[model samples]
Target chain A: MDVDRLNLPSDGDGPVFKEPWEAEAFALALGLHERGLFTWTEWADALAEEIARAQGAGDPDQGDTYYQHWLAALERLVQAKGVVSETELTERRDAWERAAHSTPHGQPVILKP
Target chain B: MSHDNDDHGHDHRSSDNHWSELTLRVKALESLLVEKKLVEPAALDAFIDTYETKIGPRNGARVIARAWSDPAYKARLLTDASAAIAEFGYTGRQGEDMVVLENSAKVHNLVVCTLCSCYPWPVLGLPPVWYKAAPYRARAVREPRAVLAEFGVTLGGDVEVRVWDSTAELRYLVLPERPAGSEDLSETELGLLVTRDAMIGTGLALPVASLSKRGCP
Candidate 1:
């Protein structure tokens, strides 16, 4: 099937971002592709699997979740590649949350030293 | 780096819900990528920094200033925004099918993507959190006046408020009406007066005096 037929917002010309995180996610995905970490075909299949999973789990199927699925696929691919274990990923996430919560509003959130 | 899962138990608290889950997912992926040498932390910071500070509403400000200074350019901008904006090399993924909305004395324009968070990235770097949240999306279409008021924008009753719902295929950028006493200002000066919210139609460009007071050169 043609990827364009997927009709995802990110597929064509449209607003690039609705939030900073979204842009970060977009850049991360593009960066990964550039580094040869995953082929576009692999990326697409992973993303498709994620969206399919979400749909099966009752995701409304709106474009609102397009990026969420993208992020999930990224995580799955990286884990599958053995670049990082799920345990390490979770620990880093908790660390970030602690750091972010401690940071003041309007200030850039940084990981604590 | 090998992950020792036996010692560390999963923290269900961090991945239990929506926002938290998303944040953790992004953070985890970032750290993993960095550890694998697939991406540099500094490089990612630089990329995010470019969008956050270096390249942003300022680019759109220049476009608005040029349109204000040149009538023909304004016409071109309204007729075919993509080509006109590409004249300055602001063409990309989110800006391919660009539609320029001119804020007039009689008609005020506001943009939102009710279905999702679609926004012009070439000119405007990213959508603010409020623009992406459920409240703003639902209210912007249902109660634009209230939403605009929350943003400190009060349109006169006589001025028609036209809210444009951005979609995946097309995006809208508002060309805010030039402020009074800005006629004598240079194009570059006019650009300085334009704000990010002005192009989004949520706020107007600052006055020349205010711009000067804000230390804008």
Candidate 2:
């Protein structure tokens, strides 16, 4: 099937990644879809909802933090899907913050027990 | 001990604000997904790796190569990029209604999404963070030459720049003019010279000599 509706912005440039983390975020969404955790349509709907919600909250929708909203939608759906609880998600987020702060320079910040 | 590494030394305070915060949230979400067995970290890594190197830019490179080497194909790509791209089975979500913009000696094309980071995933994959940032989005349309200069792209004074605003209905891709002395190069070799930035108008395609020096596959 031809997806004639997928209109993304580009100057015919190859997939240029500005940062490492953005790639990770893109992969996460694709990975989740590959694992059958969600369909692209579902993901699209969720992402659209999140964007709408952000706009309603006066996000300005200037194209920055688009992935932030993407991650937010992923979190909401994963939580709703029973993959994780809201409390657990927050705890883990805090843990990463701590890990990032504690880890040395030029090293990966992995969570530890 | 201060958690201030030389690498992440810039903006320690604001660092915790945008990218870092989103990163932590994503990491947390990944952990939760993994814990629930809904997703595997390995699968995630593989997926990212695939897009990072294997399947993304190269696909676009092939398309660009074809257009460069074949005038008829080039005409088709400029006329109907979506249909032309589908010939190679590169049609999918976020790639519908692709409009190929041709760069020439007189006109240069740049693209941006003012509303969101709607990128052509089928051929280009995910967009760079800067492309999705407010600074680039805001400045690209207002002062394209300045933004391009920041990216080290300085157009000739004689060349006019056209900025395409991407919406949900139309996506823009740039088909850069073939570099000089590339006439003898094969399609594969031409593809090698075509970089993501070249297509995005931030940089020119690599010269044939540098193409081999770069050790691209």
Candidate 3:
């Protein structure tokens, strides 16, 4: 993975994935890119647009919310490329929330069919 | 995890709930993407592992320590940072274009990414939260003296302060002056004196006296 082309918020080590979920979001984007869903330039452009939009919405431009913007950009890109629909994403998210509530603390939240 | 939660029962639930939504969202996205055959679970694990276990400030500390003990290496570091750093096998990503700012008794170098958190990842690892926060980004260039003071780095009036702004194209690392009385220390021992904040120019390298007090032989 030529992560250099991503233009992600990073320090000396590489990309900064502060949490497990942040890393997952980053990998998802990379995975999609690897599968030819989008080019690195297109991904960069989408992330840039998301950051600009968030700034416009008074997001304070704090670094902690960086991954949130990354996630949003991924979502936007996947939908735009017809890889996944917004409706499916929304539905999946809701299902996850329901699964999480029903699952006990420390238990894995498995979405049941 | 269970033991710590038992000790701090009140704080546990909030921490769990805080990241729950974001965690679930990512899980949801991953599941959806995987179901669509767009992403693989193993690939995600590999990416996560790379960032989590590998790369950090220890790499930069080694570089700084070598420079301190070897003048020739220090010259190469200042002349061509990227190549010199590559010698340590720390080349990739944000560290492609590197600049080593040498700090001296006469001049102090501080680094910041005013636009965003662009750093030399091959060396330093992740930037601290404050380094990426709004206040440090805005004030690092405006009144670096005050910022340094806040970080407990009080510079004399005679010392010149230089602020280096890191970008996506170019990143800067401060080669902090070796503390006095460290002449006898080995290169590896000297590495222990190098702190992440020192390389970032927010603090100085640990003094030799402090090392001895910490019981280092």
Candidate 4:
């Protein structure tokens, strides 16, 4: 599945708010970063480097290329550094199947496992 | 803490709160259509259709919030997000082997449909109307910084951006770190800290201690 989200507002360069949902997500990330868990500077640098690599590789997406590189970078960090484990991915997948198959009423179904 | 505008935080506006008084009109239409047989039992298919066609990234935002708030679950999510999200009872025909990319000091995360917009539906619900807007799709992948700037997210030259090329086999979501000083918060409160921008890796979560100092109730 492709992950395409909405345009969220920023503080300095443009609109302060865009879609309500994206705004909420932005608030959470900002909160996490400010506490020194991670720095936006590092995030920006890594993503830029990834984008450059992609460009060198002849990416067709071009300048408008958004987060694809970022996602891959995150994966590299997680796997390389063990931020999160691969086994976790498998366990969660099994749990999700249990939850998805059991929930009712077209709402989110919390998994029991 | 106070918002830039000095306003204290507001409580979450639950889905229930959004129903308009004119909702009766909507109900009336639904009944009218049903009675008129404009749609049949086969019409339930429309829920999936409408979700696929009309709903936007807000749905994805909701899913991200849930994941950020629940660590054990989030752990499961990052590992096999598609299945974990499916446990919540939302499944999009378009969603599959989903991977959640988390924020870290060395890496930043963002997602784009390199070929076309192939978004995860079950977890994100639906792609926002603008996501498919050619201008946005073209502009987002082209000048991410410039585009992100329009979103009010400014990254200095020191920051690095990594864009992912989404394929039919892989789907991605940005799993931003949880905010600090909120170690005591409930799942709901933690969820309040999540934002759509974080999921797309354009922004960060809000801090709770700072929020507390600002008279957050």
TM-score of chain A of each: 0.83, 0.80, 0.83, 0.48
Q: Across all candidates, what is each one's fraction of true contacts kept?
A: 0.25, 0.39, 0.42, 0.02
Which of the CAPRI classes, incorrect, acceptable, medium or high, describes model 2? acceptable
Give one digit per residue, the lDDT tens place, for model 4 in B161-181: 777756655778887767767
Index of the highest-DockQ prediction:
3
Docking class of 4: incorrect
Off by over 4 Å in 1: A1-26, A30-113, B1-24, B27-46, B215-217
The all-Cα superposition gives candidate 2 an RMSD in Å to the true structure of 9.0
Question: What's the DockQ for every one of the candidates?
Answer: 0.15, 0.24, 0.26, 0.03
Better model by DockQ: candidate 3 vs candidate 4: 3
For model 3, what is the error of residue A9's alpha carbon versus the real structure, in angstroms, after optimal superposition? 19
Docking quality (DockQ) of candidate 4: 0.03
lDDT over C-alpha atoms for residue B150 of model 3 = 74
Candidate 1: tens digits of C-alpha lDDT, residues B98-178: 999999999999998765566787888766555554456666788888777766788899999999988656789999989
Q: DockQ rank, highest first?
A: 3, 2, 1, 4
Candidate 3 Cα deviation (angstroms), residue B116: 2.1
lDDT of 4 by residue, A4-47 (tens): 34433232223222332232222222332343434544544454
Q: How do the residues B60-126 of candidate 2 rate in per-residue lDDT, one tens digit apiece? A: 8899999999999999998889999999988864324898899999999988876566667677776
Error of 3 at B153 (Å): 1.2
